[model samples]
Target: MSAKSRKKNKYNFLMRMRPVLRWVLRLRSTPKAIAGGLGLGTFIAFTPTMGIQLILAVLGATFFNLNRPAAVIPVWITNPITVAPIYTFNYWLGRHIWEGPPLTEVSRQFLEIGRTMARLSFWDIKDQIIAVLSMGRDVLIPLVIGSLAIGLITGILVYLFSYRLLCIFLFRRGKKRLLNNN
Candidate 1:
């Protein structure tokens, strides 16, 4: 993209994020609370838990004394558009980290699953179901492991960055406005 278009895109992205930023700023909570809540939400979003993420984030934020709204906002990161890619990358990373199953084995399991689904039900063959479940175990273990690793690192980075930004844009600006009004 051209420099001008890139700038416009950047501006548009910021505009899209404006509502969340406004919500953050409107809260009377401490900067740490807001940042921690945002960080907690971000961390929860990266996990394999799809439906319960929002609830988890809220519970975590409440337990940890973080801002609830800030905690819930980042959970939207794992919506339909993003869930597949994020989980796929995490699964890939997990496979590398723990070396779950051979690629050929995974590929074979998928093909077998497809064939079973197409012809008869997977429940039709108990042995086949067992094999698929075992294969699933191999896949699931690594994905969870990798997602936790990524989430921890990302959550920490987000906390630090959000804290710094809140300090700069919120507190510093408020102080200036107060002084100007005096």
Candidate 2:
């Protein structure tokens, strides 16, 4: 398809999703539960796992007594559209927190492996594993540490903010109901 059509479709999809996002934010549930769920879901989102966020969120919510729907839904924040930037930021943050070999070194090793794979000269499996491990050695540690730090901070902040927002919403709704009854 043409680039113009792709852009138009993406824009239209985003427009359609806006209302759904509003509905999610306005979801009617207890303040504690919704906030807890938000915190849990957000925490899981920051972790390295991309494929099983829903399952992780559900299990975390269940284990933590958070709202199931609330917890599971927000994990969509890490979809393909946002994953690269998010992970890049997380990796940067992790590097700041803990020292690791430079990304340049890591990238060089990764490219070497790619070149080997492309040539298909029948490199030993051990060499491939070593190349991968070297790549991971520099990236993984920082990513994990940074993700944990970002997740914990963001989750706590979201929980607090969601709790207050829900409290206000419920209070206003209750006041309106009472006024109507009068």
Among these predictions, the greatest lDDT belongs to 1
lDDT of 1 by residue, 75-156 (tens): 9887545655676677777888887876555545545544543455423455434533555677878878988988888899
- Whose TM-score is greatest here? 1
Clashing pairs in 2: none
TM-scores, all models, native as reference? 0.77, 0.70
- Residue pairs in collision within model 1: none
Report the poorest 10 consecutive residues by lDDT, candidate 2.
116-125
Candidate lDDT values, in order: 0.78, 0.74
Model 2 error, position 40 (Å): 1.0
Can you write out model 2's per-residue Cα lDDT over 1-182, one digit (the tens) per residue? 99999999999997998886566567666789889999989988887555567788999989988789889777888754565556566777899988887766644543555555444433354553354345565687887788788999999998998788778868887899999999
For model 1, give the 10-residue run with minimal summed lDDT. 122-131
Candidate 2: which stretches are off by over 4 Å? 1-22, 25-28, 104-135
